[model samples]
Target: MTPTAPDRLVLVGGTIHDPATGRDGVIDDIWIEGGSIVARPTDPSSFRQIDCRGLVVMPGGVDLHSHVVGPKVGFGRRVAPHLARSPGKPAAVPTIHATGAAYAALGYTTVFDAAIATSAAALAHLELADLPILDKGIYLLAADDVAVLNALDRGDACETERLVSDAVRAGRGWAVKVANPGGAVFWRKGRGDHHDLDAAIPGHDLTPRRLLERLADAVQAIRLPHPLHVHTANLGLPGNWRTLLETMRSLDGRRAHLAHVQFHSYSGGDLDEGSFGSGVAPLVEFFNAHDSLTLDVGQILFGETVAMTGDSAAAEHLAHTTGVPWVSHDLHLSGGCGVLPIAYKEKSLIHAWQWAIGLEWFLCATDPWRVALTTDHPNGAHFTAYPHLMALLGDAAFRRAAFDRIHPAVRKRSPLKDLDREYSLQELCIVTRAAPARIAGLPQKGHLGPTADADLTLYRPDRDLARMFSVPAKVFKRGVLVAEDGHVRATPTGGTLAAS
Candidate 1:
């Protein structure tokens, strides 16, 4: 018989944490070949091998939504001159190349730049192509684009379908995202404030609710992997949980995801959130009953991070109130984007209250599988805070320690300090890895299972959960080691998963 190669790359003697298959801390080997997993090979000599003994091996992370590389991001960079001088904030957020490198170093092997307007798609792709070590994708921010909005108002489902496909194909996008829906047009119309879904957009005769439903139907009609990713109307307002709930109710049979949901769920409908934590119960209940819906926590970590969004009005509101450096761009009235620098303070009443609400949503939600974890990157907080957030969830003592340092009034009123539920490693896998990829409609990206994609990470075991996740011992993208010992290695190849 002729000698044949094993046709596999074996990662041997590693403890694999594959939440998809319920495999935890089992010192087993994983075999990868041709960018997919395979059965373990017995003949070690025939296979290229990596020694991963005593390491916590898991699938690479998948970020469902982020604005790391897109039009709004460029707008932000252009607007904030002083922000350009900040230590972390760079000229153009340290370039697309740096964006990919930083994310990969943090063990995120796949990231979706949440909102790229169809008109600005080419510009987004230009940067995404240069992104290395992470499979990149984009969501088309089509809120009040005239042609589609016109078609929707006329009840032209056929034309709407055609336009949706045309836009996605032209944009080379992964999914659809609607930012403040009809309000984008209203902002351009000089209204600058459309608080309710029923409020009219300037040129179109449609309400935000109508726009939301139609775009969601359009996305579902073509059988897109992900649903309409929404930033929702009236974000960051007190009593906005009503809007959030109403938004959820409006998505009847369709799969609609709410991005940065923590920002949208507020207890009191106010400029200062006097009745904080009041809106959580109903919102949490609605989420528990709804399975078609998906959400990312967008948990606020107390620190200064650049806030950028496709919703110009919302950003402008934030900028004006905070009096921070702001940036706004008008994209032919279809929608605009705004950027501002923000900080969540431990001593400030509103910031402390906001902090409590975030943790409330995390604990109140029934299932980890339904909610993914994110800082909404450079918005609520930087992506670097993910490790610390994980630490809070994993260690009760850490959560209490952090909670004790907050403003006294907030500490007295907050439910988070009273509620104690330490999340297991398996639960961490669900929220951070498995849930995000599945919610983003990438079935293969998050799991380490038979025939799964060969992107994986290995961490050294430590009681300090934050440090453990912050620096993985070895990180892989498409079966290739890309980062190790807190540094990026040889530039490795990755994919940009998109729907044609």
Candidate 2:
């Protein structure tokens, strides 16, 4: 359905929070015309007006990482059947309608499914098409294709370049994501536990090192808006830090983004053989130096969350450990994915440590600009935890309250408890709106400014975290009222932007 603009637009008496435009939130009126935001009209006539009194308005939310559709999502729905049917759960993890409605209700205006196999792009698009109230797109899975990997292995970079471009065009994807690079294909051919970057992937001549380097260079060469979205090797294993470092070193001069770093951060002592938190210090230093690098914390919220990823082995490991009903599938013609239900318990030592590590990343990282807020969407935890995370960053007391609830191990050396650094509105704006928009390569989002899409959120200013996020006073999508006082006033079909 085509979107038709309504005549006359004025958002009156609202505390507008558009960080992209550097509006540190002044009470003002926003005007929109032809689906684009405009400066206030000198003449009051020739416009439809929206009463935004006592509401906070900003650009729509943009999700940088999520598995919203395709074979993997189907597998998730099947594997975690109870997750979809569980009462009181948010829509992001359930049926298509629930995902769309849930996100919109929370004021998310734009989101991207971080990984989708090119062979199954059409199905992914169809799923995104059914999602409501947010512009969405998928990053194509490019690393597993034999022809492309083979070409790169031979140092024929241009041929590899062409295949990547062709895949993007064919898949109509926003960017390319190389997940575990050649490991997926190798795993299918019966190579077990290729956890390091230097390990030989069963069928491919290219090591994960060569695969990452070539893909990073090709993504740089193509000059897409977003870099190669990489899910590194050694995910969910002990002593995988060395692998993560090598993966980063492989793309030293090039541009790239790492997905779910917390899952990749583990210590050698407890869980597995000598495989603990090896890579973070260098990884952090490298990221601080490289302006091109961006990452989402993938902070594990530790609840009845679902762990889903395009990496089949990692997901299978999780499923095996938990003994839950797990689902997995290979794109056959392309890559593969797996999903399992996860719970983060206060009494569980490992889960407590996982939670601690995420906060440590938040406190330890030098610049907030390089990082964005993400629960890795049901992987580490649920997306609904964002408000609590926001509160953790905002109110010191709230952070303490949450910290006290966790296991004692988390309270010991974890920085979350003793730290009293409260995030000012400016910092909150940076993490949620400003930084995310820049990372996702969408200039129009994450801010309120002239010519921007008039997607906004109005909140009843309060110290309550969940209340602030879940029940905004008013929510707008493209200058139209979509939610009012926690009730959906209208349903809008949001567009998913793809680069074909």
Candidate 3:
């Protein structure tokens, strides 16, 4: 049994990479008291000091976008039971207990389920309660509600704001997420024509563009900490880059967060595999210029993993093309979700292109602070692949070697070949922890400074970025030692972070 954490402790002589406080590779002593980082005590003898000399320290990771729990996640497990267990490997769709334990073991202290229907928020919350160690929250698909859509259609800003605010409060959600906007409405009607953002929803006068604008207005008016979280139209479709670009343009300087942008950054036309390639260059240019927008890569690692999304239409398209086992459920008025098992092969042209495109987005972006590293969790790849993705971003030589092994067509056509920009440890910290926490509106998380939550990870540095990040020397959750050397030492019930 693990002993309870001491109330006063100090992690001494650690090389810290706290980007939020501008401490880059600075050796410092971190003082903790009552589950919070505090200034050094006047009486040094009173605090227990643990020597952390030679170890690298950073804030506990914050996953701003992931689908760790919810009814759809339950469905995903049911559909692919084989994904639940793999000898010496983390499950793609882990059980609630494993999900929490794995994330905590990896030094992630906080996570947000990026796409939970507001109607299923209570159920998601109940599941999250069982997910020990990580402080968790959910982004509600509130825009799918008929009443909200109706208000948006009628251009009733007051009603839209009231309805969105009410749903957020009722569901205890962290932010408002619109998955494919009116795509589900079309899906329910057995129609696949709503590819254009300006196309009308069959039952409503509102287009996807208008819905986005109204939701942004509502989210802003409600004074929510996080902006409207958007998964734009035509996700995973070739030539969807246009839709993604238009989605950003429609925001019109309003604060918003784009989800799984890698899926949307494609240049090819419908079913044109030959024309399919990276569209990230232009997207990155726009993203760099727009301070109102921030994004998570949804980087696709070459692997076998489940693809799940609240965007049922996109899932259906993938299912039909790949001939994989697929499951989709309509959540009545609150939209729908789709889940499927998929294998991204290194030899497959499209898969290789996707891999290159995600990396291109990571490499091309001018600001690491506006970007968050994610795999869209079991969509592009499993969350467990984050360490590997980190290695790809931080080590350009490793990236080139990996790139050379992929499909030759991608080698010749993709722009990822030319980009050699490597992310430093500080940039990695910003993308993984600081940026995500700030984007998620959790200022207290993703930093190791005075008055901040005393959640952090200490790693014995290694030349191999993947090996260094795969296991930490020690992991702390609110000052309590929870994991050490990739083993879970304690299972503590962490608090739920909700937008008040």
Candidate 4:
């Protein structure tokens, strides 16, 4: 069924916090017409007015990175059936139906699955079609194609650009993504020793660095809204911070987005337990200085969540280390992914440091425009943890108490012990809605400026940021009231937001 526009509605007398327009906490009425925000209509009787005198209004949230659909997510659900049958509620990997309802209830109107192999684009889109109330798109795993690598290896930049453009167009994809570029060659060969970003592809001349440079160039040349989304090589390895730094440098001012960066920012080498700690300082400094890079910190909250990624080697390492039931599958020559359940314990040094380093990245970064808030969904933690993560970022006292409970060694060595920055409400808005929408190339979805989509969240302000954000008083999706007070009022089929 085709989606129809809602009746004219007016959210009256709300304290609007539209960061895009610099309307900070100003009391104003917002008008909606034909599924888009508009100027006040002339005929007052045509509108249904909702009194929002004490409510706080902002653009509906945008999740820039998540693993909400496709084969790997399905595998996660099948492998851990008990995960969805937890005593209190369902699993971390929610079904397609529940995922949409859950996100809408939390006030997010848009979400992008960060990695989808080109081969699985059809399957993923089928699943995404079932996702309700949120506009969705996927970043095609273009760089994982053998032909794409061969083009780069042969120094055919034009061919590489054409291949990327054609793949995205055919797949109806939103952007290009390269997960552990050239790492697939090593993984197929079972060469665990070739974990370095500089290492050459086993059968080709292309290295991960070269692959990134060429792919980044292609993404820009094609004039795609998003830069190439990269899950850099050496993910989850000790002393991988150097690898991440090198990966950023390889872009050489070309725009590219680094995904799930917390997993790639560890300080240790050789997987030694003692050598691991916060390695975010140097990376954060370089990231702040480099204007071309944008990232999402996959913040880990204490709990059980599935770790799933297209980096097969990293997934294998994690599965082996945890000695847990895991699954990995090859997608012909377009790379692969692995999934395993992980429990982050405050008493575990590595897990505690992971929690701290993610915060360190959030606190130390100088610009909110270049950063996005995410858990890489089900990787670092579930997307539902966003409210808790926001609380940790907004309240220093709450953060310190959580910090004190973590492993003692991490408390001593991690830089989070001294960082005093607490994100203001406006800043949190940027990371969650504004910056992500901008980064994802969706100009109309992130703000309440006239001509933007009528997707908004209204909350009754409270001292507790988590409680305030966890249950929005009202949510509007394209001018329709889809959710109210944490319950689904209407289930509208969201559009598949792919590039033409």
Q: Which predicted model would earn the best lDDT?
A: 3
- Evaluated at residue 388, the lDDT of candidate 3 is 95
Per-residue accuracy of model 2 over 1-500 as CA lDDT, tens digit each: 33345455887887867666667768888888766788878887887767877666666677788767787777666666666666666633677777766677777777888877777888888888888777888888877677787887887899999998888888888898988877677667777868678776675567888888888888888877788888898687776656676777778877788888877777674444533332355567777787777888788775686777888877767778878877766646577677777788876767776776777667667787778878888787666567777777777787677778887765775555655777766667677777887877887777778877777777777767657876777777887777777666676788778774
Residue 370 alpha-carbon offset, candidate 1, angstroms = 1.4
Give lDDT for model 3.
0.91
The 10-residue segment of model 4 with minimum total lDDT is: 328-337
lDDT of 1 by residue, 60-134 (tens): 988887777766777666665555567654343446777777778888899998877778788888888888878
> Each candidate's TM vs. the true structure?
0.94, 0.93, 0.98, 0.97
Q: Pairs clashing in candidate 3?
A: none
How far is each candidate from the true structure, as Cα RMSD in Å? 3.6, 2.5, 1.4, 1.7
Worst 10 residues of 3 by lDDT: 327-336
- lDDT score of model 2? 0.75
Question: Candidate 1 has what TM-score?
Answer: 0.94
The better candidate by lDDT, 1 or 3, is 3
Better of 3 and 4 by lDDT: 3
Candidate 4: tens digits of C-alpha lDDT, residues 330-352: 63637668888888999998899
Candidate 1 C-alpha error for residue 367, in Å = 1.5
lDDT of 3 by residue, 1-500 (tens): 34486488999999999999999999999999999999988988888889999999999999999999888898888888887687877788999999998998888999999998888999999999999989999999998888998999999999999999999999999999999988888888898798889889888899999999999989999999899999999999888888898999999699999999999999898654668888887788899999999999899998788889999988988999999889887745366699999989999999999999999999988998889999999888888789999999999999999999999999999998899899999999999999999998998998998999999999999989999999999999999999999999998888998899
Best by TM-score: 3
Model 2, position 123, has a per-residue lDDT of 88
Candidate 4 TM-score, true structure as reference: 0.97
lDDT of 4: 0.88
Off by over 4 Å in 1: 1-7, 42-44, 78-92, 270-278, 331-333
Clashing pairs in 1: 238-268, 238-269, 239-268, 239-269
